[model samples]
Target: MPEVVQNVSKEGVKYIILGCGRTGYNVAEELAKETEDLIIVDKDEKRVEDLRDQKYNALVRDFSNPGFMDGLPVPEVAFILANDREANLAALKTIKSRYPATYVIARAIDAVSVDLLQQEGADVVLYPQEVVARTAIYHIRKLHSSRLALRLYDLLASWEGTLCIVTHLNPDPDSISSAMALSLIARHASHNKLNCRIVYEGDIGHQENRAFINLLDIKMERLTPQMLEECGYIALVDSSGPGVNNNLPKSTRVNIIIDHHKNNTQPPSAVADFIDIRPGVGATASIMTQYLMELDIPVSKTVATALLYGIRADTRDFKRNVTPQDLNYAAFLLPLTDADLLDKITSPSVSLETIEIIGNAIRNRKINSGYLFSNVGYIRNRDALPQAADMLIHLEGVNTALVYGITDQNIIISARNKDIRLHLGNVMAEAFGSIGEAGGHATMAAAMIPLSYFSMAKDKEGLLTLIIDPILKRFSEIVGLDGEGEE
Candidate 1:
């Protein structure tokens, strides 16, 4: 064993690099800027000499040999960077046996070696190939996003009039934030040449959703036919097409569609010039964040917070239908988001009507097999249906929950499902598509039937009572339930 040549004092040595390979040398160079209490050792005499020439404390030693580090001071950290798997594992076991307290970071040639290295007491295992592949993938995604951003900019710049960015009716955090992001993108892409307005058709009925908009001060207007007519171009956010979840007329022409919903009815390309619908993504806001990053646009604190909340809400805090892309976008926005504002947005005061609706849903609940159904009577707050359904799904023995309420113009429905065999979106569409609009994701879904469909009834309560049984029966049948349990 060759002794470590002391270029700098080895007193209070805290770090050691066991190889002078490419990764080890690069790490040593970086750590050199932070501390001089580090040494680099390699079996190759020429590599050691080269490191010493650069003023690094270099030594020629066989790290895989037992007792190689016996005379050296116990380092707080040791990096074993040999490419040979057997040598690296041997080095790792030897170091951990002597200095059990030392944090050993070992390099592995592959995943199998990684596990072996860790079992031998490597505190961390670095697979350089995996690291490089991940870095490359991240950059490639950014490059692709930049190309898409440029294409979107070119499309926006091609048109010269006002751009109406539409969100789905009763816009939640995801749709609202997505629309806001698209508006920002439109402003940047057109260089302020396009007048952009965030437009929607339904009320921001959820209390938390209201707080999100009020806290962020997001500007959105109710969509009117005149606004659509005035705009030279139109874009849909969190909505795939006209007359789908939105109140847009079927004849309306859309220029751009950005959504994360899985829609088989109308491909966005058929309805829009620029379409970015990725059903695999948890939120449309994630797609918007990608655009912001690739375009190098400055994200405001408000926008950052909204986009973060949007991702959380759509993904249910990364628990539902989440993908790697959503997480990546969220990580990018986390540092820029305002933590206090997010807390306030997510913890808004609950409304009395919402509580009452939830109470009604619980009181009127009916169970058949594992399916739970509830009618919340008549509701002025349409957003409460989903909240009620979300709560009902948690009941014991229930894998699916459906809540419906009668509004003045529509019979609103909201559903939540955890049964792996069930597809709630398709079930809702099949159950209600003939009389109304309905669709959503697998774990969640919704429907809306015009009250006019049941106008034959004399009164609201009578109408609700008469139609509830049939609707529940139809839904139960669609889900393939065998028997109707006594309620």
Candidate 2:
């Protein structure tokens, strides 16, 4: 790569760009799939101002003054792409000192700083000479790939083509939106590319979720034992692995995987040529949003609204697990989301069933070990469990809220917390250790218990007792309770 270096080492001025500034339009395009929190910082005020004008968050102050960024979200991941080796190291050091956990990937001008930057905790050191030369080569290869696709289309006698089976780990607004968006991209970009049918596992159990599918009318093929047999290719979103119920047929290979969750111990990855997993990102919709923008694709009002809802719900409206990509993509999608329609999606009315569930929770709620437990009986809508858990966390005595409800198919449990008492995913996973699948974000989690299975326990009382015991014990552990109640 060093021998192929042609362009001067230019780094860190632009981050999370799908393409270079017109050089090839997609410099290191694969990086965009992996990149989550991308920030471009420069000592030049004009450059920062220019970026700010373009809706990029830019701090004009010099790097020497830490106070300059008191309010701004300091970048945890730093890319030292500057040609000057000295300044590059300074930027890397500054980022490291500020964000200890940040992965600093620096561009070494020569061999001198490569090893030194590696020792200095730079996760990746890119040689400028090599990357610049490959940029042109990358563009030509992309052009050829597209040309080949077009050429192949003319040869296909049948209009009907294969389907890209798109689904996610746990179906949510972001995951579904991305699956739809990606399929749309793949269909439009390739002249004679295969048709795609979006599919997913898990219930679309959120208000925004209902709005996305209903308003957008994005057709998602329902996956069943029979459907999996015919599907030849799979595209996974939100999550990755076999532990998830969305597992494709063993013969059906995965073609692409776009996810935002951190990697975990899951089954062998599906066969995918393009795999983009941004762990630091809050939403995969953000990534797709950028692709549409760059490709000059016109997003419909409903699609925009869905994208906005997807980003907002996934990030909790930029409260947690947010990154520059999320913010930038959100800024781009804001105007596209109808102002009047947003009100409808944002504060959709709750069902009477949900309201009754809340009232029942208030009446039968128990506060013990600084935890709130509302084992609401049978729930018509499983979505109510998450809303119940989220509401219970606001109660004064509650640091953790576990809301469990039995639906016809599964016993759904939702957990919400403020402190690091217990990782909700692990808690729910252990609770359903050998029963059913359960995993999610650190602060929020969802578990499914097959009623047919749970109800078949030795006795009715025993089944209920066994299911609720884990919640009680975990809460007691967090609050230092000695297995006894507050009394």
TM-score of each: 0.84, 0.63
Give per-residue lDDT, candidate 2, residue 476. Answer: 56
Model 2: per-residue Cα lDDT over 1-487, one tens digit each: 0111112144332342211222212333344455423444456656556655554443444444444334445444555565567766666666667667766677787888888788778888887677888998988965764554343233221224655555663477787777767666666655546667777666676665676576667787667766655655556766564344465555556656667777465655555655666678879888778667766667878778777878888898899799987998899999887877777767777778778887776666777766677778776767777887888888887777778777656667788877685676776676564666577767887777676755545454345556667645754564465755741
- The local distance difference test score of model 2 is 0.64
Model 2 TM-score is: 0.63
Q: Pick the lDDT winner.
A: 1
**Candidate 1 CA-lDDT value:** 0.86
Tens digit of per-residue lDDT, candidate 1, span 317-416: 9998899989999999999999999999989999999999999999999888888888888888899899999999999999999899888787889999
Candidate 2 versus truth, CA RMSD in Å, comes to 12.8
Worst 10 residues of 2 by lDDT: 16-25
TM-score of 1: 0.84
Residue 7, candidate 2: alpha-carbon lDDT: 22
Residue 215 of model 1: what lDDT?
Answer: 89
Question: Which model scores highest in TM-score?
Answer: 1
